[model samples]
Target: MSAAFFSATYGEARQRFLEAATRAGAAVGHHVHPLTGAAGEEIGTDTALLGPADAGKLFIVSSGTHGPEGFSGSACQLALLNDELARRAADRGIALLLIHAVNPFGFSHLKRTNEDNIDLNRNFNDFATPYPDNPVYEQIHDLLVPAAWPPSADNEERLNAAMARLAGQRNPGVSSGQDKHPDGLFYCGTAPAWSNRTIRSILRAHGTTRRHIAWIDVHTGLGPYGHGEKIFGRHSEETTRRAKAWWGSDLIVSTATESVSPRTVGHITGCAPEECPDAAITPTTLEYGTVPNPVVRRALRGEAWLAGHPDAPATLVREIRQAVRDAFYVDADDWKGMILGQFRSQALQTINGLAAEE
Candidate 1:
């Protein structure tokens, strides 16, 4: 059953991934995270590679760039490992790289950002240059992350009113990314996060020699429930045309007017060109929807509040964290089935596209 491949905790998920990698005869490796898990268990970003190391084509699937969102991504990776996809890729001489828990701290602790509260998705820019500005994010920062866990009714009313007036003006900072506020939502750090560095290193090692590479960075909590919205990972015309040809017309270019995701800078996939300059890359984010947009926003705000107020009551703490989890993961049998089914289909399409030239 699809539910069988899913796990209840990050520790359990990591263990299952390692065991499955061994069972599949994958070349396994680990980059240990500095912090322990929520249960005080060890934490790390694990990798498993199937097929020849020097394969000309590479297929990379990564999970947990947003912490709890890893639940669906991890399940998809686990399902792939146990399936016949590996053999098919190996037959085509395509190396399948499974990167588990790119943000181990967030994955283990149930927070979307890393230990430093940096949104790893927004933390992959070149640090030598000046960081991007988000003045609109500055305007709504106080409303988005109020002083209290559950903000007063008055605060909510004013925030809602402001949002209504500013509708279409810009995203409320959560999606656009920011650097001014360290504890704010979607905070892109002033420097490269460890997760950022580690993932880039992984790509440099496995992708440098590849002629063609396709990366699927699995995500959750956008679009309709249980539907995997394929967002083209890059903005360039060449990559955009190739992606549409491979993933079909259903693919959503994030820069489009009707896209679910906003056009944000410094995505995890943004590092690909710099690291794997020689390879032709087709990247996408397979985002599965869990809850509605408002619900997801509330959950994120509550979690951000909890981060600043660790002394919160245990009951309140549990409530906030549970909301965060539900926003990213729908732990039902049907949802698991949908996630696996969509991911599997995309994987097959990617494999076909990569093997077409061969």
Candidate 2:
């Protein structure tokens, strides 16, 4: 199917995906919560699950955990159900679970963070584990968030200096400028935000008692545009080997390696393995690249400016919204094709891996 045919707004995509799953004879479950955004938009996080309620092995494909990033993930999910691949998986006795719009407020507003401006991915630390503090983020936080809109050239220079010093062609697993500007980009959040809480609730609600669990949390930004990097959820050699064997060694990218991928910090995977301890949780992220990271960072900066400057001109807001969308979605047939094709292939690999294990 064409990507254009699958394109949908967050709510529309969720509705269509659920409908397709139901029509395919898959059981559905929903968790809804109300959220009032900074723009006064009443958005709700609606999570839907497909497949058997108590299946031994569950293959989870989740989208919109980062809001706007849902465009690709949602399309991939819808395409899987609408395509013949879903039937094949079902016939093999594999349960497919689609978690749509994990962060609805972010998806609705085209912002990366939830209504509370919290990066849900970074909000998943075990409460008992001390929240890792990024002291470097404190030093340059003010530079990232200027008092004026459209930061001055000097501000950009300062940001470049900070990036050069800390990130230096590599994300050091700690963001610079977090302590001073908690509201700025890469802000992990003061604590577990609503989106994080909601996802945890979903995991507890649907993830218990499963024998094997495979998760593909879709994301965009950070790597070569249009390619999906399969990042491992755990560092164990056994899990890494399993991921490579299942997804093809060439397709899997390890954060431990300096290859084309960058290191991640405070990721959601930390919780998945523990969430279903009884299950051999083989969690990995299928991160489809959008624009360059620097460009993405700049777009995020624009979003932050818009969120703060609510009175900004309508034209500027629209431009920023488009930029945000282009940064992730890349409205092109080839890009969407690559995303969907890889998504289906990986989903099948996961299902087959579980069935083989059985």
Query: What does candidate 2's lDDT look like per residue over 197-303, in tens digits?
Result: 76777777777778877888988875787888877643678777777778887555544554454554567766776667787778888888888887887788788
Best by TM-score: 1
Q: For residues 1-358, what per-residue lDDT tens digits would candidate 1 score against the true structure? A: 9999999999999999999999999999999998899889999999999998889999999999999999888999999999998899999889999999999989888899888888888888878876678777777889989998698998888878876765565343346788888878888898899899899889887889999989999999998989999987546788788888788999987766667787677899889889999988889999999988879988888888888888999999889888888899998999889999999999999998889854
Provide the overall lDDT of each model, using Cα atoms, as 2-decimal numbers.
0.88, 0.72
> Candidate 2 regions off by >4 Å?
36-42, 47-50, 169-171, 174-180, 251-254, 257-261
Poorest 10 consecutive residues of model 1 by lDDT? 165-174
Q: What number of clashing residue pairs does each candidate have, in the order they appear?
A: 0, 3
Candidate 2 local Cα displacement, residue 335, angstroms = 1.1
